[model samples]
Target chain A: MLSPKRTKYRKAHKGRIHGLSTSGTTLNFGQFGLNALQPERITARQIEAARRAITRHMKRQGRLWIRIFPDVPVSVKAAETRMGSGKGSPEFWVARVHPGRIIFEIDGVSDTIAHEAFALAAAKLPINVKVVARQGEGA
Target chain B: MANAIKLAATARDRAGKGVARETRRQGRIPCVIYGAGQAPVMISVDAAAVARDVHASNFVTKTYDIDVGGVSHHVLPRDVQFHPVSDRAIHIDFLRIDAASLINVSVPFEFKNAETSPGLKRGGALNIVHHEIEVRCRPDQIPAHITIDLAGLEINASVHLSGVSFPEGVVPHVSEKDFTIATIATPSALRGKEDGEGDGAASPAEAAKA
Candidate 1:
């Protein structure tokens, strides 16, 4: 099994299954929706709101967690190298937005709870919990 | 059998590495459409448009309504070519899927549940052994993904290829008992506890009996 860290590293330095550049991009292929996730509609306020909601949800859910919201200085390099990726932000400009499109990554949980959490988020926010890519040992 | 996506395409009169590079420079991707008992034909497509659709999960099976030299054809992705350096699609292979023909394709796995699983809650990590599995099905009955609800799976439990249920008229080519698709074990800090406890109890019991 591939760890999320190894997977990201493989995607960055080695190559990715989607065949897209990892120079700055995270996901290259797989099922994703752009229905309302167009780049133009994102706003700083909405990102902040989503960040707060997700962070609170993670804390309330009772687990060690990390958050990566849009315009939070989350570089592909940082994601490929660092475990937490980066930090939170409230004043960064909105890089992109779609009403319900988001990337939610949860670790150290069961499939059932993960799914439920994903469903809950999807229902509450304009985002989709596409898939989970876990890391290997020490990842 | 749900929504079938269609896109316009064109057959290329010129073929070769140079032609392909030129096509890319013009914001087009080189592609090929074969199968249906016909010879392989080279083609090109709008790079941006295909990229958006390719980002979707079931890229290959989705019917692309392509127009090649004003001729319309329904196609599915078969193979992809990427730039060695850029990793962007340089060439694509689309097969003209026949309604009656059974084709082999790899479908994605969508795992559900994370926040509520006992294993995950206890710090056990979920590791997907297979991201996609190959199955035989008609073009129209192609499933977008092989969704598995990981609602109550314990740590070390797996969802194998045999466990995957397909849509009507779809069947996995893998024989019974074949160990295919799966989400298996990735021991972490949590597993250490189990290992410690298991060894401690077993060793003490064996020593006392001796």
Candidate 2:
């Protein structure tokens, strides 16, 4: 659903998501966050679904930042076609989320409210999630 | 600061997704050099080179002499935006710098003499509080890394910023308070285990979690 308008002709090999992330490990602009505990390719559709769930819970109260963007082109062969032809054209887009990557963050709301919001969002994903608060300053 | 490294680029006429995609197609990263009271200039540099420079350990502290067309402009890399999924350098932002002006930068912390510390000799781990510190220094005075020696530190001892000697004319941005840089901390559970008692069981809470 979030395919880039133009892309390179050749396909790209799937790369490994290893080690802890450096930047997204901290909450830059949010109170509560959803940190990915496992490395997985989060589909664009899943990101959209999680964002919708978060905003729906917030109901326009707080700010939300989606740190990762779905830019990887995921190619899939047709369901019923016979195998062993050529690589399938780019099917959709996905974001490779690694451990410690903050998938979602929310601010401008109470701790319980943000916690509840991210919980609703996390239920839509396919990886283990940890809800963390911003470090230092105050609770 | 280390001498500014040379970077080669060309001025671009347009700035947009269309142009950026086209630039990436040619294996060059689209970038903008601004922030010196002059209008922003769009340019493109070798994507592979950008990737290499960005991965350098001291990328943030180093200055660069970016050659835009035939003219060279001294600049610092302010930001490098990578494609989220592919994790490749897609855009770079450079800020023009004057060699004489005082600028703020975060320099990585380098600790020394951990081997001689009494705490470390007793199986304590060095817990770093700040991996890097923000300091205001001239473009020429930025230290590659701030070094702190823990030669005489004991268990639970911490070295504050005031204890370390920064290069002359380099002042910390957090001068209002003496902040901690690192500490020699013993894992409390391991501390209990090393108490000479044969019993070294996990605490109740830790056991429950396990």
Per-model fnat list: 0.03, 0.00
Give the TM-score of each candidate: 0.55, 0.58
The per-prediction tally of clashing pairs is: 27, 1
What's chain A's TM-score in each predicted model?
Answer: 0.36, 0.88
Proportion of true contacts reproduced by candidate 1? 0.03
Query: Which regions of candidate 1 deviate over 4 angstroms?
Result: A1-139, B184-187, B192-210
Q: Model 2 - which docking category?
A: incorrect
For residues B1-210, what per-residue lDDT tens digits would candidate 2 score against the true structure? 557888899999988999999999999999889987988899999987767666443567788898987988889877777543345677888888898888888776777787898987775656666767888988888878888998989988999887989889888897548888877766434555455432222222233454
lDDT of 2 at A131: 88
lDDT of 2 by residue, A82-125 (tens): 99898888777788888878888776456887888788888999
- Model 2: residue B108 alpha-carbon error in angstroms: 1.1
Poorest 10 consecutive residues by lDDT, candidate 2 chain A: A130-139
